[model samples]
Target: MSLITCSKGHQNPEGSRFCTLCGEPLPEHNAFAGGINTGLVEGTRLRDRYMIKYQLGQGGFGRTYLAEDTGRFNELIVLKELMPTGQGTYALQKAEELFQREAAILHKLRHPQIPKFWELFRDRKGLFLVQDYIEGKTYQDLLNNRLDNGQSFSEVEIIELLQQLLPVLSYLHKQGVIHRDISPDNVIRKEQDGLPILIDFGGVKQTAIDVATQLAAEKYGGSGTRLGKSGYAPDEQLRLGSVAPHSDLYALGVTAIVLMTGKPPQELFDAHTMSWVWNRQLNLSSDFNKILQRMLAQRPSERFQSAEEILQQLPAVSTVPETRVQPHLTQRQITSSNNNFIPPSPAPINTSGQGHLLDNSVEVPDEIVGWNWGAFLLPGFWCLTNRVWIGLLSWLDLSVVTLGIPTITISILLGLKGNEWAWKSRKWKSVKAFKRHQRFWAIAAFILWALFLIIIIGVILFAIAIAGFGM
Candidate 1:
């Protein structure tokens, strides 16, 4: 089961929905928000080069090993072994052909949602395909956990899931690459970003299966290793062994329904009737319902043609994360009662390295936000450096007429609102970089302020001495 860490460092299962020790309402667990489907090792070297750590799994193709690339400072990698035992002479030929064509293209595939394909090499033992190792639980794992607790994914979850995953398919299809296999097991909700990363591309699987199927037919006189999973894959791809862009769409639609109902494809699909019987099991919005239905349409031509079509039709901005309530009030909320005073930073949202941006919103990160000494000390000058141009309003002469009340008020306002405004106004390379820049200015401001105070005190002392001497 997947676990979530609470603020107090308590690890809680996702299903528990709260910190077992603290009883704090478990944070909204959206780890696999669009999870339709679906690592690490410190040890092991392969072919005297990659260090093998652990055996991930095994099947007709061969074994998968978690290995470390010593050359890359032991960066984690996944090694898929293709062992078509006793496939005779044609084994290497078939492997070479498939890997050269599919692996070549996949290696060139660069996308945030897909793992970086490393290399495909053969050895005395067998063939090995390498790729980056992603760390996380598959949607399937999460679904199983939920099922263990007598709950399935909700409608909202599926909707958000589609919002996240469809774009990945669209990119693949545009590149003329078909995932071939896209079950919950193939999609992983990355531990780092909480985004869905499509993994286990069908290319290697297909290559292994092709040779495996040949061996099966020649020896056992049988067929095996269908590229797409039963029920999850449409009839045509599984039966014909041919796939198109829509083939992936059909499989994805099946994966979605399975996630919602917490049931496998075998139970959800009616083979005898050649139709889906999942509607009675769960309630979904009509719009999303229609979208899934069209995606699952049995005929390739009948289904939505592309992932783009489905994405364009999915429920709108509902997938966008809801704005978090910061302790600070928005600009419009500022008031004269001092209740409008800017808030002190709230506890962090536990999003380190997540890089949540406030680009188009007022959301302030708890850690990198709060009173800005630089802005408060030198509002007019600091505004230019931080690119918060509007802050130059501190230069307004209204302070002169108000006996410095307005100037002091503006400075306080700058102190309170500076971080948020600067964050939104400028393009920062990173949160750390932004913090560093602000720290530098703050030190400068403090040094300048200290010098000014020292000078003022010295002048006052001299004036006092002069008055005493005159007396």
Candidate 2:
């Protein structure tokens, strides 16, 4: 005998509160009460606008519908109706409160990545939240096609995808909004622009103390409770109680891992042990692997503190150092001013849109680009230094010079290349004349080499003097 039945009078889960025909919300009774068909009735409009069109989707606690706004003007929005999860009447009250909280949270957030909130309405049907209707397919759709086609994305492609989301997360975290649910299902990749849009605010938690106070929040989505998807939730998120930004980072790490390996992280990584799958074909670089490992750390504190900090380490998507601007002075100021600044009124500097000033006359420094010169040469600086030191300390000076000189030169070039990153990061604060002073360092290096040779010769002469007595 069928005990549990849906609104269409069809057997369903015990105490189901949804329709079997359309999956619409049924009357509230109890947690395990049978669903009831209230018969179709036009819901009462709230604030004299937002006419309910039809049901779009329904969950255990709420029903979403496509609605038209008539109060201010005719605007299209998806209205989520907060309905009771079970047949219990108390469930209706609790669901209404949750829906209101969701509305308040949504209204506070405004980001390019998140959907825009339209309005919140409550009337005969129940509490409803209207939000932007993003026209696009979810990330799940892309992942599905990727699996079907046996598709693989390059590191650069993955970076481009994350470049959009990381900044979004940074903004959200700064605003104290923790997006507890971040998975392919919630991410919408637009066909027109090919950018991922984060949706589904029902699971979003506002950490802002002031705004959070307005809406009485019950138990938060914490770790150990397994609020989010199994593989994606961080150690902290599964516990339950308090949620943090790193919880989202854990999900992001899982998302990237899945995208790269073409398998859910659960299949590859054991959250309990934090171990990768048995010898999966690894095509990614060691650096990327290290990044994922850090983000998916068992401890929240061990993960990258913030999205901004994580972006700093990623070479592919990091922001280049802004170019420094040279201040443009009037002819009068340049010609006059005692050849230097003499005026009490200083000339204004404009750096609105400019790159770093460069000395066109001199060649670009090697430090800006990491170009290893010694890779082509055998027996590098260390080899050269050993030969010189061993020869001078002993008696084989000629043999040492022959082995060491070329290696030393190659090592110098490599050192310059290695130092380029540091040099480029530094803003050239010096004027043109100061820029020319860099040549002095080159001259100094040669002078130091000459000095080393002189010492070696002096040492040889002293040894010869001692040998003369034996002769």
Candidate 3:
């Protein structure tokens, strides 16, 4: 393997698109792209550097993974493995060239708001494009939080978002970097500052879309419809790859209105007229509506050519926290969920007529509700292991003094109540964990009981042998 150093003095793999250390995009003219293979299980280490944590998801043409970089003091980064639809080596090579071309362009991009593309590497498994791991919940996550009162994004919040992200887009576009894909799913509301960080710059994605589209046309005699891209992408951009800065703006406008309306673009736009009817869904100030309308114009020439154009109209709007000026949307107040303490959900009760302990505060799952072998064999030791303190009562001298009748009764009680008593005594992660813990005790008890039986039999046999020898 060869290494290439960027202007920032960061050494990367020979064909890496950006410096892994500083995310510096090197000057163009150096191009390298490779194919990706799949099915690297969790914890799989690549090049003895990146340890795969787990898969993030499968995308339109690739898989994403959350990995730890051992070489960088275990920094978290995202590994994207591109899975081109084309099968032949030529097709794969073509896909790589296209991926590399877009990636090289994306390498020129650097912004705090956008996720940093680091380096590309190849291990035995496949090629991986490494990038910073953003820690935040995406807008989609916030939007889909329906059970949490189903709050929609308010006008003020949307305005704030535009203010924050429009500058980022301006930076990217100034360098001729257009994020072909902009959706609620791609924008993360960073947990640290609550500022949005843009992920999925659409370099590899655009490459895949190109390859997939080409393959579709070659095989099916016509270019196939892209199912997921339809809602966000404009007709010209989706049907053809003639994308500009306005294309991204169009998608952002759609995303903004979607967040406000809590509806997808497919629903908001009337296909019959081929124009937006989002205004009918919700009311907005004229200034905001006018801006959004210009951004979403059907013709690229009609839409705003630059992100700065959108930013100039939006002055710094003061936002109220936890305020709901609009009944339809809410800007969540800076308060913990505990402050509005809802009553704890009732515990699941055993409905099978099985008695419980601690007034049924703890659930006795049916799977563990049975006679306990460990309790029956060694009540004292089983009590220690299972936390069933009542099982120790079997050792009382009163039980032995009553012709062992009390002891027998206590053992039966221990066996019958073991599961319920243990369920109440301690906290368990799950029913499976409880069963596993009890199983170990059962095995240990059986082993000790067998050893005791063997010792008693040996002593009796030795006593008989001694008497016979004396006789």
Candidate 4:
């Protein structure tokens, strides 16, 4: 086979479109040169080392290209260009300064969840920034795929995502960098480890804001443009042009809700009432629901003060209580509060051949009152064991709404009224019979609860494995 050397000087087999080591496309010797006059073309070598293969994306501030580092054996890298549109000489200078500042911030960040910054340079084309190219799909792509498949993220999945990503946010906050833009599009879930990587810092918008302020101080500015997603950005950030760490939290909260409901933030938010109406679409654990609500609060003061505070409020999956069977109570005469059932008094009954009266009375124990822990802890199993059809249906309904999160209130109510429902469901000949049946079912309920827990754990592990495999 014949050999061809790529622009990065990597020799490869003939007819290869891209370099094996660096992913740079090999230029065709007989290819025509006529193309769009953007100054950048296929196989264009920049800085005498980096080779641009193709453009990745473009925004208001700049264009991004997938390039290869010839110095590093054609290793893949991203080159971002600072091509400010319709800006004059003075504005362009400010933009360049902002770009440099962004580069400095990126250099200071040292987290596995963030992309590594390489170097900043300026050429005849424009200002350029070289950085590591992460291999993965954005969260927005993942969400869209799920929506296309007629499925959405479950509460547990969203919670796990938040748990995994919040620490990165906390790390950034401690370093004095507020990620002004934190929408789903900005978060990439790496294919190898299923870890999220935050990308696309708001450098361009920040630069614009700085320029606007500077010009305004000199009486040459009109109005500064806002720099965040409309639905995800809080009022303070969107209206007042003030951003804080908590601002990122608001966007994260909106992202979670969007993932959970498979609906846009605009649809979920009610501008008339100035509150989110997402609660009606999904059911979530009380703690999680409260945390998201506070995070999405209209006022930043009403939200969590820090990421650590939000972490503390997240639900712990390992704290699920082990099911315990309650002890059976033997025959005892009972008095009803709403009914006039007379309590049995002490009576003597005789024994032996002659008809005799012996003590047939037993002390009545204190009434079982208040909440029932068994029902509260294991609602589905508790209902199934007790054969409460209504309870089972209610639990199933709630599970569907909350994306399979068990309803604590329903569980608690079941625990409080479980015994009463059991007694009313069947006709018992004596108190001893009722006690025997109740004890048997209690043991059965515990067994069912154990099986339920095992199944849930297995499903979670399976999901994690699939996610790790990028399936």
**What total of clashing residue pairs does each candidate reach?**
13, 18, 1, 11
Candidate 4 local lDDT, residue 230: 61
- Full-model lDDT, candidate 2: 0.54
Best first by lDDT, ranked: 3, 1, 4, 2
How far is each candidate from the true structure, as Cα RMSD in Å? 14.2, 24.1, 19.5, 24.7
TM-score of 2: 0.54
**lDDT by residue for model 4 (321-374), tens:** 221111112123122344444433212111111111121231121242344555
The estimated TM-scores of all candidates read 0.63, 0.54, 0.58, 0.59
lDDT of 1 by residue, 121-190 (tens): 8664356788899999899888776654445666655666776788888889998999987888788988
Better of 3 and 4 by lDDT: 3
Best model number under lDDT:
3
When 2 and 3 are scored with TM-score, the better candidate is: 3
- Tens digits of lDDT, candidate 3, 118-165: 776655534568888999988977877732454577776688788779
List per-prediction Cα lDDT, in the order shown. 0.70, 0.54, 0.71, 0.67
Residue 235, candidate 4: Cα error in Å is 1.1
Ranking by TM-score: 1, 4, 3, 2
lDDT per residue (tens digit) for residues 14-100 in model 2: 555443432323333323233542322356455577776766554433456676777647676777655443334444455556656
- For model 4, the stretches where C-alpha displacement exceeds 4 angstroms are 1-39, 86-88, 212-219, 318-471
